[model samples]
Target: MSARIQEPRSGGEPRRGETLIQQRNRKIILCAALDEFSAHGFHGASIANIARAAGLSKANLLYYFSRKEELYRALLTSLIDTWGVPLTSLDPDGDPREELLSYVRRKLQQTRTMPRESRLLANEILQGGPHLEGETLESLRRIVQSKTDLIRSWSAAGRIPHVDAPHLLISIWALTQNYADYDSQIRRLLGEEADISDTPQTFLETLYGSLLAS
Candidate 1:
């Protein structure tokens, strides 16, 4: 069996200054872990690599995260937290088309700017999302379900076409995330002959605008 990893020594309680430092350290470790995990994936990534990327010793890195699974879970949790907002912010009080388009824009923006993080999460899921299956997955399901409920309500009110809510959300996720997850293939097919940065955004907007138009 693999040896168990050690938790931080600072224990459950920390002083005000210590808490601040802990937060800062955890933030750095998380960022470094993002890069490492994104580049090398979970099994290929290591404490030494993360610590080096974060400019800390392996022991110091462990001070923030108890083990590799702990660190990986933190990274996935951060991705969920960062991307959860667009879904949660879908206002029932707002126009359905605008709300969904706004959500599409936010998701596409993450693909454009934070592609590594996007792929990292996608990779985890492709491998069955073991670490992402617990509370993190539960929280995501709740958010998606709540928004899907709003979409259903809108459809019932004759605001949007009566489409399958969960399937619609899945389609939106696939369309937006494909750019990040398949970026290499996409860029290769397009070659250097095209400027593609803003095209995806416009294309997505138009596509959803037509699909969700009442």
Candidate 2:
């Protein structure tokens, strides 16, 4: 009796026997690709390096993703999904102070937890937002507009002081993510003792109180 060879699945259909090893390999490739893209940017990262980092041959890496661009897109999409959670939580029905404070805390937590992803996004923006064109840009714009509307409503209802809603959102993002994106400068200026996470609550409390106080 001869053993039968199994074929891998594609296009939303499963093969007869997709092993756990294949699933694990896919995850490893993704993790390695993220680190590589984050460190080198899309133009600088190489498939061979990613393959070596992923502990797979270039051919095997290609088996999961057809090309380098495909892998980079997958990583960017994953980052965007994770990065958008806090933004999506800005609530119109919630108390303004609590809602904004929660947003600040969540942004700070993401900064500490996913600094690499922040850096990757910064790199993408610095490179002229090449990968984030068309529908990607439109989707992001829509989300920003929705949040800005909520901010405007908060101001109109006297829940918060008057401020440019879009600019306010920009400012909040800048202040919170600056520590992570500019960690080198921050570390140099403030020394190792400076902890961003410890200061967000206090800083936000003071800032928000001053800005929103009647």
Candidate 3:
């Protein structure tokens, strides 16, 4: 019989090794940095703040991420993965309304779970996407373009309305993200209410259910 070794999993305890320790520490730092960067925009955010939030010395945080920009980039990269997940499920093989509505539903849930991440991205873009320019922007553009093309193809095939695919997609993104980025305003407007994202989520279903009705 051959012995097997388990590689460390994300968010799990580290093994008895230096690399595992580094990985664990890196994860910790990134989580704290995500909160800090989300609360304060990039320039307003700092290495010292992230280190303090992570309960580590500035030197220790630097050991994992050498610079503020590097750490910010890392945070952006992770956020992209999280943000992209729901959109990536738009399958050409599925029924258009079902698939599209599923995407919107999941995105609504993400806003509830990842409101900080949503706000962070919004803040970055509002600041003209300094870190998000170049390769990052290009990669994001490519993904959006490909999905836009898919929607266009569906429209051409009469699978959905002849609505402008890009515009429709943009509407979905804007509508869903608003709940997260403008949460305080929405909550205040609600007046003495729990933070129930479902109100908007349900509204979206009814709205899109009508808008995309074939």
Candidate 4:
């Protein structure tokens, strides 16, 4: 039950200033929570189950997270940080063709490596994104708008063909993330052992290459 002890924090909140051990424990708890939530969803999951998966008691988990919602929010925050990496790497100063293609490659790589996180975000959006409101949503909007503006600038400079910046970004997301969000359907339709390797990468690069060529 992982010693089943409670640590005091301000207003029973998870500590903002965590020690090394606390950081390690928090990471363990979030990892376990991700698996549990991704499999069963928010309403279907329980703190007790996550605790068991993390080798901690329910109370021990609460000492770190306070509530299931908080834990879920933390998980989403971590996933957002990961998802932002590829988007944030888009360099307006770089060649438009290379930058956009690199973005496609990086996004596809995330789908392959972080399938669970991608599916988790998709599930949240399917549920109307109750947890993804307010500041988190605003932050996302700002980041996306910045990239879209960058894409528009590329078009204005005649670096790429005239394209709707927002929809182009949306299409890239839909195309790349389909592998993660619809893995089961894709696998069932293709084969049990179907491995989507460089096919999407090659096709997308070719498609966008033609679009981005000045």
Candidate 5:
């Protein structure tokens, strides 16, 4: 079963069966919320600020999202669903090495493309994920458990070297997410105007390739 979050549109697309204006406003609000939430975490972010950022009145924003917590959680749910897309595609029947490598590549792509979303999630987690408590947390755990079990099976079958499945997954997340979460640090070291390279993709694939070799 896919572990993707199946919540109705909240912070993302307009809810089903809404007028076009409502759909447009929801999209605008979500984009603005992403900016605010990324800049300031949940506690520091406010409905007023998000409303101003969205070019809507506080009442208008509230009409779409009744509460700040509601808006924040909706945004988070949408992000997790987006991130889960690549993860859900990790095929147990595929060659273990290739499957894992492809996962690494896709994660790196997300790191580069969805830096704000990545940082937003990082902030939530660093703060103990106060918003991601109920079903969201359960689904995340279920997905991680499923992937780890698959990794363990690969190890048992001699498809890959004996490895700590959970830590291996954690390492992949840390390696990929650092590129976005600490991008300022990376820029400071590499120089602001310097041309970025595809070293992350090359280095990660090569590293995991060796680590997963049977």
Candidate 6:
């Protein structure tokens, strides 16, 4: 990991006088920390490694985040904020095919923009979601349930073909994220220039068309 310096916050919140340098440093630390944690998982990652990656000293990094777990939680919380964007975009009034296609596109975009974050999330799940306990788990469950409900509503309205809504969402997630989450195998199978994002739009058009067209 690289070393990054964060601007110190006074009085527990941003003041009118905060400089761009502080914000930039904070971002650098977070970005470096995300990369380190993604590559090493929670237990395997170290504060020194994260500080080195962020271009900051261990003491400086500690000033920004008190503990490793705090930094980990901050990263995960940031991920959850951005990760929910696609789901939040599902318009109840939009055409089902168009909506689903948009969702797929948004997910692919995330894969391209935040592959490290996606991998970090996948690592957490592989470890049985240990970090997402109590309120965090409940929040996630509620969000998933809400999206599942939307899918169910679409199916009931004859806007989409009947399928297990939860499973359908899961399939969409699996198919789209496979590119980022399994890049090595995909690269080996399809070659370097084979872009997953390029294929998803047309592939999803065909898939949903076949599945939903009456």
Q: Tens digit of lDDT per residue, candidate 2, span 104-197?
A: 8898888887777787788898899888755545676788889999889888988888979988888888888787789989878889777767
In candidate 3, the residue pairs with backbone N, CA or C atoms under 3 Å apart (3 or more residues apart, or in different chains) clash, namely: none
For all predicted structures, in order, the TM-scores are 0.86, 0.86, 0.87, 0.88, 0.91, 0.85
Q: What's model 3's TM-score?
A: 0.87
Against the true structure, candidate 6 reaches a TM-score of 0.85
| Model 6 Cα lDDT, one tens digit per residue, 147-180 | 8898898889888888798888898888877777
Ten residues in sequence with the least summed lDDT for candidate 3: 1-10
Q: What is the C-alpha lDDT of each candidate?
A: 0.78, 0.76, 0.77, 0.80, 0.83, 0.75
> What tens-digit string does per-residue lDDT give for candidate 4 at 121-159?
888888888888656567778899999999999989888
Worst 10 residues of 2 by lDDT: 1-10
> What clash pairs does model 4 have?
none
- Worst lDDT run of 10 residues, candidate 6, spans 4-13
Q: Write the per-residue lDDT of candidate 3 for residues 45-133, one digit (tens) a residue.
A: 98898899777999998877778888787677667656776777889899988888898999888877778789889989899987775
What's the candidate order when arranged by decreasing lDDT?
5, 4, 1, 3, 2, 6
> What lDDT score is found at residue 117 in candidate 5?
86
The better-scoring model by TM-score among 4 and 6 is: 4
Model 4 accuracy (lDDT, Cα): 0.80
Winner by lDDT between candidate 3 and candidate 2:
3
Whole-model lDDT, model 5: 0.83
User: Which lDDT value does model 3 have at 104?
Assistant: 90
Of the two candidates 2 and 5, the one with more favorable lDDT, higher being better, is 5
- lDDT at position 8, candidate 5: 29
Stretches of model 4 off by over 4 angstroms after superposition: 1-20
- Best candidate per TM-score, number? 5
Residues 1-214 of candidate 1: C-alpha lDDT, one tens digit per residue: 1111112222222325667777666667777777778777888898898898778899987876778988887677767766676688898899898999999998887677778788888888887877776766788788888888899999999999888999998998899989888888887999866556799899989998999988
